[model samples]
Target: MQNNIKIILKIFIYQVIIYLNSILILDTFHEVRGYNITPQGYLSIIFCWISFLPLILLNNQKNPVMVFLWLIYITYIIPVSIIFPLINSASVYSIIFVCTINILFFSSILFFRIIDRITIPKLKIPWDLYKILIIGCGIIVLLFVISNPGLSLIPPNIFKVYSVRQHFKDNTPLLTMYIITNGGYVISPLLLLASLYIRGPIKYLLITISILISYLIYSSSGLKSIAFMNLAVIILYFYIKGTKSISNSVINIILYLFLTAGILYLIFDFYDPLIHWLRRVFFTPTLNTYYFYDYIYNNNSEFTTEAPQIVSQIYYGTSGSANTGFIGDGIARYGTLGLIINFFIFNILIFAMNLSSKKVPFELSTTLYLPFVYTISNSAITALLLTYGLLALSILLFLFPTKTNKIPL
Candidate 1:
């Protein structure tokens, strides 16, 4: 009982430090990016902490999935919620709605303990068939990369990605696109992980081929997240191998990454890539949510399912997608009530993820699932499963061989 109290106290302290770090980042947003962020006095601070209580107080850290989602809330949602009304002429309702949805989101994670207790039956494929499946997937990825028009294997500049992405999308058939993406994103990474148990030149070959294919996929798709996924898998593999604590490692990495981004932005005198990335990742989605509520819903616009697209079209004069959060999409699609709708659908994914994490090594399953989480801030559930390979990845996780069932590679 005493030890439990100490752990809770430590997490609470870390939560306070994270909250302060968010304030510092928001101040940078106001100063560097010219966002008009001002606190609406102590009440806003108090309300923000109130919404944050579920995360700080609840011991949801054992699940890395929950920890990562909370990281998003800390970095993106909390800072924006507090400053929205002050900057964008946002109404009290917007603040209340975002806060309520966030509270529910964080609180729902507490039920993961209950959910994890429900055992998910695993059906393992025969080792021979599994080997064939892995080999077949690798062959398909190679064919796709070789046959694709852009064969440079050199990743496009981040600024030039849209054009490259459009070209790739226009040429690739939808089904083929998904298959190849799953092959690269899911199959190759799994192959890499499985190779760790192998003992021979074949293991090195698998690693080399996997790395090459991942680079080719990123180069072809112009998706930066692909590269990050590879990095995430490697980091998780070694970290879990050493520490065997996925949740704590993930939480610390997220906090440090955010802190480093904020500190770099504060100290740098000139523009740099990290600053651009920091703005894009940390600020854009939250600011876009502000625009969504203030500009779209406030104008009494018709409820449209294409909220992110519409926001992108109107504000940026581009037909591309906006960086709208799930709640923003909810508000723009179905008004305040849509938050509840979005929450249910979003939690279904969370529940599914929690279930999968229970069956496989948390590091393997969670890192493989990271791409889907990366898209949640901007993507609908349909897009996540269909467009982003969540369904395929989930199946792979369920089928993944456990250590006890290991077969020679």
Candidate 2:
């Protein structure tokens, strides 16, 4: 028992550390300063945390999933951190991204339970479904690619380019909030791969073609970064699937990422032959580390400030396009502890929800989807929605389910 307590504490501490690191690591911004504690950002995080108390008390048992997740989080991150031609953007943010996904998983759990009273189980799958899914992806992606303007080749820093929104007037930033350092296009592959478990090849192919076309025409142009990210996604997805143990998965992810990088270099030589050749010859760890470190420490125009208007200006197109959001501000306000606490609280809620036996409510699922994705995407809103949005209300309603008062959980 004593050992278990100690182990739990260790896991808890690890999560806390990771959270804070994520907050501070990525200091990118479109504004001269970071976003301030406006009614929206501040109130949201606070309410989100408070709403999560039930998660702490409810799921309530000592479980290893949290610890394993944290462990896997760190392991998956370290391998391909090298060869980054751009800023690493909060090292801790990656973990935050994963933890935020709890909103989705947790809410789903709640939905299952609530609807369990009247809903039927529906998870049957055909044996040949996965092959069809893959083919479908290829077809869809190819169509999307061919339909839209095809890039002759993927470019460097393709990883960081996000949001296809362009400005019509000079100095006009788009009025959107989701622009962040994304592994954007790379995730497309994982989306393709996910169809593996589902039914249909033509479906996956069609889907891929659609995405490819959308990307070429409507999507952002940068895609080189996605190459590395896509590789990471494949590794991370498998790791998350838990087919391999944490240690084994991490080893394979790193090796495979490097291997993929090599293959990409050789195949992509037709595009930017010079740089590709250069990276092959001299993309050393020392250089990679030095540049990443410089980005985090040396660049700080937007890391320290908390002016809401400034943030709003850029977010609404007054200043400039913010490549990175309030990451620097989050780190400054809470340091690494901030990121960990945020993620831990979110993860704790998700674990609680998933560990539960049935589907959560639909309202909860809807609320959870965007926030869950947002938090994982390194945004502040996900945590808020988890705590105070429709999901929380849905959970409350679920706990006291109706004239019959059935056992939801």
Among all candidates shown, the one with the greatest TM-score: 1
Q: State the lDDT of candidate 1 residue by residue for 224-328, as single tens digits.
A: 666666677887667665765445555566556656665675687543433456456555676677777766567888888777777777766677777666777
TM-score of 2: 0.36
Model 1's TM-score against the true structure: 0.82
Cand. 1 Cα-lDDT: 0.65
Stretch of 10 with least lDDT, candidate 1: 269-278
- lDDT of each structure? 0.65, 0.33
- In the range 9-121, model 2's lDDT, one tens digit per residue, is 44344333323222222221223232111111222222223223223212222222322323223322221122121223334453343233334334433543443355334
Stretches of candidate 1 off by over 4 Å are 1-43, 83-90, 148-160, 244-246, 249-251, 258-275, 316-319
Listed per model in order, the count of residue pairs whose N, CA or C atoms clash below 3 Å is 0, 50
